[model samples]
Target: MEYILAKYNYWIYILLMMIGLYAMIAKNNLVKKVIGMSIFQTAIIVFYVSIGAKRGASIPIIAHGHGHDVIATAVSAAEYANPLPHVLMLTAIVVSVGTLGVALAVCLAIYRRYNSLEEDEILEQLR
Candidate 1:
């Protein structure tokens, strides 16, 4: 129980991913599937962010401009957190938004063409 309590974020991320996967795989509506995809992407983003975070850690940047013309403060790497994961996650967020926009546009196009959003209804019309 102590271990589970310490890693509850992981469990929440898993639950969110499962919910998104189920919606994408089991739902009939194209819009719902797109929403599920977004949800899945969000869960992944949160997971990465959570993994990148450390308790009581400061940013990687060092400050040295306080009442001195020379660099006087020195901080080891252990004192700062790595910013790569968070930076990459920012890029991922932009890409996810773009993908969601394109996917919803595609869904809109499908609805216009078939007059429906249900996958089965669209397939029946195609047949």
Candidate 2:
């Protein structure tokens, strides 16, 4: 029970990721697949951000205009939340948005050409 309580967030994220994966794999509609991809990207971003979280930690930024002696003694690595994961996630978010846009555009083109969003219909049209 204690283990489950402590790691509930991880379990939730895993469940979300699995849902996205299922949607991507099992859905027949192009739009639904695109939405699933977006959900998968979101789950990845959330998981990364969650990995960076620290209990009793402050932001990574340092205050300016404070005395050098005070600053030197007051700041420590343990006191600040990990910033690398956050920064990487920001980049991932931008890339995800761009990818989503491209994916939607492709789906739009597919819809325009075939007049259907269903995978089976598109394959039939292709044949």
Best by TM-score: 2
Structure candidate 1, residue pairs in collision? none
Q: State each model's C-alpha RMSD to the native.
A: 2.3, 2.1
TM-score quality measure for candidate 2: 0.88
For candidate 1, lDDT tens digit of each residue in 1-127?
9999998888999999999999999999999999999999999987997787777788756546366654656656666677888898999999998999999999999988999999999999999
User: What is the TM-score (0 to 1) of candidate 1?
Assistant: 0.87
Give TM per candidate: 0.87, 0.88
Runs in model 2 with CA error above 4 Å? 64-74
Looking at model 2, residue 61 earns an lDDT score of 77
Off by over 4 Å in 1: 59-72
Model 2 Cα lDDT, one tens digit per residue, 1-127: 9999998778888988999999999999998999999998888888988899999888877656266566555557787899999999999999998999999999999989999999999999889
